[model samples]
Target: MLSHLNNFLPRQSSLLMKCNFSKMFCFQCEQTINGKGCTAKGKCGKTAEVSALQDLLIEQLKHLNSVVHHAKENDVKPVTTYSDHFNLEGLFATLTNVNFDEKRFQKYLHKGEKLIETYLKNGGEKLKSVLHENGIQTADFSYSKPLKELIKTGKEFQIDLTEEKRPVTFTKELIMYGLKGGAAYLDHARLLGYEDTSLYHYLSEALQKLSLPVSEFSLESLLEFALQTGNWNLSCMELLNRANTESYGHPEITTVSTTPVDGKCILVSGHDLRDLKLLLEQTDGMGINVYTHGEMLPGNSYPELKKYSHLKGNYGGAWQDQVTEFAKFPGPILMTTNCLVPPPKKYSKRVFTRSSVGYENLKHIEGDDFSELIKVAKKEKGFKNTKKLALKDIIVGFGMNQTLALADLIIDAVKEGAIKHFFLIGGCDGAEKERNYFEKLAEKTPKDTVILTLACGKYRFNKKDLGVIEFKGNKIPRVLDVGQCNDAYSAIQIALALANAFDTDVNSLPLSFAISWFEQKAVSILLTLLHLGIKNIFLGPALPAFIDPSVLDVLVKLFGIRPIGDVDEDLKLMLKN
Candidate 1:
């Protein structure tokens, strides 16, 4: 089937990207509708087989979501933060780069567990019509499946190892990976007593429905789940935004260092703002410095986080660089969430996992055990001070409250020609060589441009000397580092504001969204962009796996989305458009 579409595939995608799905149709994850963009193989590592399975899995999840949504809406069990947390784990597992630790089957198992429980009460005979069964011998796999099995089956839903060919090159796989990050973040927020509305139910429902056998599910239904996956993730991040702001205060302009002081220290990374907060408390005046690493750089923006005297500096660039950077840092690292690549043996023992983040042998600090971290900090020497590395006291904690306060001024400045463009140059970061395109793109963006970035993607150029812009007496470079990947919502809001100010559509604004995607968070953000009808935004370094040729066509035709090319070319295109 892909052979026929080969004629339509981009010349660059002229590789062996075939996968068996149906007799007449072969899918390489999310290929372009007419085969113009989806490289024959999924940009994500999802195999041709896993590509097929994902469709089926999402089929199951949609069916499951229908029933679950109805139940929750009807006030059946009254889903809470806990349920949403677990839902995030499963929904995000199917996302690209996240949850690689668990098997794809584990995801199915988790979904199975929920389906069985829901089915037992609703009865297989009655709901079986609406709910497609996997045809397994187990009477109630979703109901009777053990906790371990839940995880195993859940991972199966994550991706099929048998058919999920390696060398994961498709964007779908990375999108899946990103979903896991979002899932983990959503899960953590739940653990800390945060709850989202329908997003949780939709996630569980999608996961549960994705298990349906081919004959039992419809393609339209599958597509619905995919979009719903994006929609729900948006909700999850919205909750995260609220939780982060209300809990840690909104992110403001602040400068953090990649260098740590020579003294006892704890390095915090991932998107868990709360964990970082707690660590800050635990290390307060305790002779331990808390160094932010990877995604944790945004933690410096929160007033609640900055108030910590020991919350010192950042270390390294992004998550992928950890293998090398962690080796040199003289402190214990606490990974609060996803993007945890295998640590080199030298520093593996020094790593710690809190909450749902776990590795096979990596010691995890669970329940409330800072004793291990404290002991290590006392034993090791952290950076004495960050005098040489200090970039200046950047104004950090700026949430919507702060941004909105400047709304009038920002609008006036735009009117006065001081601020010509608002560039959202952020997205997920990866180790891929193609990623350098973003660095170059950022370098070439106009000097008058105000950059709003978030996620690990910002790390690529955050350290660059972009210089300051004149904004209402403040001469700070317009490069604003918003918080984590999910915080893209802030960017969206800003766009909407500008649109309203100009009395025009969002696309009519002078702002350009140059996004770099690596995982599901990017996917969700992209979906939200489409949902809002934002168009011609540049996306890179690749496309997703699950986007079938037909679906990609729909995206391009309906939303005008495109993969980013050479930075110079892309910049010219953006400027012209």
Candidate 2:
């Protein structure tokens, strides 16, 4: 199918080169229409030029990584940080709805090229072999050129699908998406001062492999790369799990308020708890309050972070509702990481980005100093009075440590037929109305069943009264909040413990996964599940746009991956099976 589209590339490329840009072919996120690639514009409001610049930036990352790989093979010390930094930021920038600024991507591409030039200039005979090994036919030692002149050459680096089959391309994209997601998690861990040099080494090697010609790689090789992506993502998750728990202590089971306080306030969103910790520290005794929003809601569960009195509670739902929610938020909002949508004019001035997150005309904070945000918060009319969005507090912090402690009771309840099944239903959430399916499924789940949820997806039904069950004189909440998306590691741990207790594999247990994915982090999580041999996962609101029909068929046959059916029917199917 992709080859057929490339038949007109001869004419298309000519026209694109003349215009100094080309059409984009992106379907990285779940919102892609009809599950086909977006040609003219991205569903997330990204333009062709921005997508092209992102691809160009990734291409340069590949080049930078190949240089490092070549240098390492030749036993030469290289400025590997050049490649390492880009590997983290560049891939993160390409995540769905993360960065839409063409100029930012252009700067990254230029910086990446200069880093490559430095490698070539410093490298000798060993560098030559390195370049050859990375599929570079020739080398130019010149680094003095206008940034535009170099950026214009980026069109030559755009992804071409004439040679590779669509399924293979889809698999490659799947693997790359997983790596991008893993890199985002790794970045968070790095911010907390955790480092894994071996993981970084494998990451560069994988990026270098992406630089090789498509014709040289086979489907089998692509499959292996996808599996390796899962392996690396597992390590990345483990590293983050350690970093988060060691720094913040294991998450404790607690109820978080969904209300606003009567004072000047700052709303901190995204997945970074370290930023939240910093903001909470600075805001302490300042007469201003701090609140969590979106994925940051789980921050309320961490023992270290939750100790702050100013850390009030969660503000909004998921990232999709930010446009309307941020405006209603009277105080300043700080987006510390990904899942940022362009703010509306009404609230654009109130939104600030930090760390790899960026948008045009928005203030970008460089460090822990959130004074600007504080000033803005002081100026705005914050919650004039305390108002509760929910009468009852939402439960959170049911991580592996907390869940495993109840293993004996859970097992005994299962034996006594008090607990029927466990459904792990959560991941990234989106704006699609079809996502209501998750809400319905969760609402309809039996009272005797326990629902394990994580990430922003839990917001769809977290506020509901799912009721509690009593078994063997122990009380267990029906819905368990398993921390943030990264805490899917906790879910994995709980599953393993349960499987071990039952003397069976995870797939054989009375457990099911009904996952909702909107972006690459969900992709990484799904790959990790596959790597663990878990099967029959029901994924929606829609399958990824990047997957070809044939490729999806292969996944279904091998892994029992299925799309969500009607809420009632799917719930019944999960319980019956």
Candidate 3:
């Protein structure tokens, strides 16, 4: 796919030469070009133009947020419905691998300018006075320049140039990344008609803070704000949890097939349940099998979704493997959210992006109308027959509600020594060889311990038959799939319930987090853990490149967060503790 992206290269190279800028500077994910940054084409296939445009979009959002913040402080509430949704969508579009279409960022940039105008117009005199009193001049949100000029302007706002102090810049990126993750959750909830004004308010406040000069805040103060971002992300995740469950019923323990059945089919990837539900509704009884990929695997566990017999089963693993898996998938594909890899030409025409997901050449579904997507599915040659595979099935759907239903059994087993410890061995998975640490650690976990897994990271060892733990004739699966990264709230609920049952704090319980992070959502989840004061988390394959050494030291001292070491040593330490 990247080799075919040469058409974008000449223009990108010209932009770099004219502006005297590096090709790009993005290190927003674990798989950046190097451990430092992507100074050429992005490892995720984002062109330099799109990368810079996204940076400009972020700066534009910060300026809009600053205006909204002052308007609210002056007792004027700007129309929130549009601004809130736009802010989230704008931020979400910038997440790694979410959107690579320069045109989409250009559209978002124009929309952001309009939103800022609306807020300023609604703010009137009182808001103007507040802005003047604070010496906070509003930014000119004009984005009418040519694409090349706009890309050059965007270079001025790159992460590296955001703050003079490295630690301050790094901390700011941390908060910004957390906001991006939180926005993803909030956006999902909003799509389901669940709205939290407080979460929206926090987003504006945080973005407003980011717009300020580094001299206005200390590293310690910024660090505190990062935790606050985490606290709000918890609330955002809670909102999404309610939206998903109340709308689709809490996920029940389900055994989903890894093989496909004979029929025309459509594969839905990414993390949006609402889009999946809509697609399912549209495809009912159409003889088209709807299979899930990546984080969408948990959709098979939803009562509303699984009821449809045509909703076949998952057909692929994590997002990282989509390049190979998607090509083999004999149907149209719908990417509804983040973690989208650029598709190769072989299946690029068969792929379509919906919601915030975008790739320049792929077709995009607008709104709830998946008619075009369904049409392509019907035209494509889907699986002629089910392929035989060693891993035929996997169990999922152990959400908070489902897990809580088995609370008595779990607690009794723990007391009876059938279960010794709980290991949270999941997060965002990547293509790095170091990620094998998660698989090895899971494989080595004692039978007396139960492993809770979620997100794409679970693809590391989810297929491995870890068997079950039996207590007084009651058998519990050794591994529990706790849904998507969006379902982290469910895992947190399980932990809180267990802590209450054991009469101890979560840190005191025999629970260890061996998190494998790849993107911004993982960063947000980490902040939530830190906000809860959860300690001794083992994070890998590598820490965020944006985290300055000094800022990392602060996190290490404050949160007891450490990098994953040898699997044997880490497992021994976790078990011994």
Per-model TM values vs. the true structure: 0.79, 0.93, 0.94
Q: RMSD of each candidate?
A: 6.4, 4.7, 6.0
Question: Which prediction has the highest lDDT against the true structure?
Answer: 3
* Candidate 1 lDDT over residue span 346-448, tens digit each: 9888888865454546777867657788788787766666566645333333345556667787788778888777788898887777789888888888877
Q: Candidate 2's residue-wise lDDT over 1-577, tens digit each?
A: 2332233234222322222225676768887644555667888888767776777777767777877777777777678765676688889888988887766776777677777777767887667775776567435522234545544555455544543366676677888889899999888898899989888888899988877766768877787778778878999999999999999999898888877878898999998889999999988999998989999998998999999988888888999999988988889999988789888789999999887777888888987898888999889988875654344578898999988988899999998899999999998888888899999999999999999999999989999999998875678999999978878889999999999999999998989899999889999999999888888899887767666556666677788887776798788779986
Candidate 1 runs further than 4 Å off = 1-8, 11-84, 92-185, 212-231, 384-399, 471-473
Q: Counting only residues 3 or more apart in sequence or on different chains, how many pairs clash (N, Cα, C under 3 Å) in candidate 1?
A: 90
Clashing pairs in 2: none
Better structure of 1 and 2 per TM-score? 2
Predicted model with the maximum TM-score: 3
Query: In model 2, what is the error at residue 124, expressed in angstroms?
Result: 2.3
| Candidate lDDT (C-alpha), each | 0.62, 0.81, 0.87
